[model samples]
Target chain A: MARERKFSLNEVFQHTKQLLLEHGYEGFTFGLLAERLGVSRTAIYKHFENKEEVITAYMVDEMEQVFAKFVHIHDYPTFDEQFRFLLNLILYHDDLHRMIAIGRRIPDTTPAVRANKERLEQFHERMYEELNQLVERGKQEGRIKPHLPNRIVLAYIFQSVVVPHFPGISLDQWAESIKEIIMYGVMTGN
Target chain B: MARERKFSLNEVFQHTKQLLLEHGYEGFTFGLLAERLGVSRTAIYKHFENKEEVITAYMVDEMEQVFAKFVHIHDYPTFDEQFRFLLNLILYHDDLHRMIAIGRRIPDTTPAVRANKERLEQFHERMYEELNQLVERGKQEGRIKPHLPNRIVLAYIFQSVVVPHFPGISLDQWAESIKEIIMYGVMTGN
Candidate 1:
């Protein structure tokens, strides 16, 4: 028999993230995961009951890391700086966007999936609250348009990260262009 | 033996689109498709060699429809009106976005897939050309910011369609909010 390797929750989460990104939710399987981890399928079963449980645990862990970043927004002085930080965070963590898409498609059948969904909702609420605060501050500072609803601004900022990367443009160029478009309207002078 | 129902190319295209949207590319299969259409597997085989061929054909047809809409841009008076029409078309055809996502994941293994990819690229090129014209006109007319690059503006317009729909907000509200942000921006003063 092959020697059984020890694995921590962090190891499991990292591998899960990689698997999810590589194959998406549909292709993710315990057998593939165990093979990748150099362990028996029973080893994985010891950690989670099913694929849904593994995915839910991984998502919950990822959300906590994202929440931590949101909590640190208070350290930034200007709304623009805060906004930039948030944008960079989203752009760098491309996996989060893919995960969100996959998560939406996963059927919420098990109790673990339902609980994870609730936790995900809570994370979203917290993120939105922080975003609202940033927008309100931007309005007060005259950095953001006061006329636009907070929700609209919130959605605009969130959507900026997912802008399709044009074939010819470099990543740095794409990031700068998106940031500028979000900050200033594409319209010319008044 | 039961009498076979005759189906047109258009019928196959339409039903294939419905299947791709409902089950995604992975779940889509000739067996399911034939059953859904109340036809035998061999009937579908007569039209398509495999799922890839069906998808490519469906995509080509859909792109032609989209391109036809692009061709009518000259009928609109203002760039803003033209922009709204494009946005509305994309927003209402939610399947287009989903199909694009699913299409990207489909492996290209055959001549049909390659040909379809080329046609899709051509459609994109045409769309981008039209978008560039609109952006240039918007700038000349003092509607769009003169400093922003055409590519940036193009990305912004395309990205607007995929903005996450905020919970509790009506579709009209979401549409209006996105339009305002893209035009006036979230910033308060010029």
Candidate 2:
């Protein structure tokens, strides 16, 4: 008789992320996941009790990867360069943007969901702290406005990542346009 | 015997919009809609063939209302005033934003769905045309940058409407911050 294959935790997370991105929360199912993983339903259930657990695990992993990218922001010489790098990273990672946009809609009633939410919050808090540091640096370096609230600035920066892409525009052009619009107001003072 | 109550088309559209905003597309169903409207499922089916039809109809109605608001943009003296007015209107109308965000996920294989999509496209085209005119006016008035494409400016404006609200900040503050960030940017020259 042929032996059944075993899957690793990393393998499970990779497939789960793909499934969530492809099907969204509503269409994802443990049965479909098991089938995709080439394993029996019981085999997959042995690892995760329910769909929420898998989803939470996937999000945690993805968030960690994203957080790691922020560590290198300081490596850039100027705040403008750092900001542009961050913007390009976010624009290219469409899956991550979609995941963040839809993350709030995930039902979080269970303990696992609560844990996931807490971890996500921590990541956000850390991100905001890093962002604050950058804004302070920008202010000192004469790159950021002094009077604007840090929170509002952060919101605008984060929001730019999710800006809708126009049809027929190349990604490079879109990125450049977005950077210009954000860095300089649309208004052209005569 | 007393006469039975009959729901009008407008009533159906209003209730459908409410359900969509409350439960999102996944939770919306004809059975639930009928129960909320005090009508049988058969009665709902008599007017709309499926959930897509109901959603498309609701979107069409809502889009028409939003489009109608653009007519008076010229009433404002300056493009800046008109821009702020439009921004505030979009920010306040949370339901419309939610509907537009969720509208893309609706499946549209049926003829009814296709028809609804066409109508929506027409409304979008009209709105874009109006926005372009505003952009031209802004350029002539020296408010908007002369070099920026109209589409990029429009994308930036629309994206601001859906910017995530920060915790603990009042809506008024958020709006002011966004306007300032968009108008003057985060950089300081001094």
Which candidate leads the pack in TM-score?
2
lDDT of 2 by residue, A161-189 (tens): 66677778877777887777777767663
What's the distance in Å from true for residue A96, model 1? 2.1
* Least accurate 10 contiguous residues by lDDT in model 2 chain A: A181-190
User: Cα lDDT of model 1 overall?
Assistant: 0.78
Any residue pairs clashing in model 2, and if so which? A144-B188, A145-B186
The TM-scores of chain A alone, one per candidate, are 0.84, 0.81
Per-candidate TM-score against the hidden true structure: 0.84, 0.85
- Per-residue CA lDDT of candidate 1, range B51-157, in tens? 89889889989989877876787788877788778777767665676677667777777788889988887887878787888888888888887766788777777
Residue A126 in model 2: shift from native, Å? 1.4
Residue runs of model 2 more than 4 Å from their true location after superposition: A1-15, A34-43, A140-142, B1-15, B34-43, B94-97
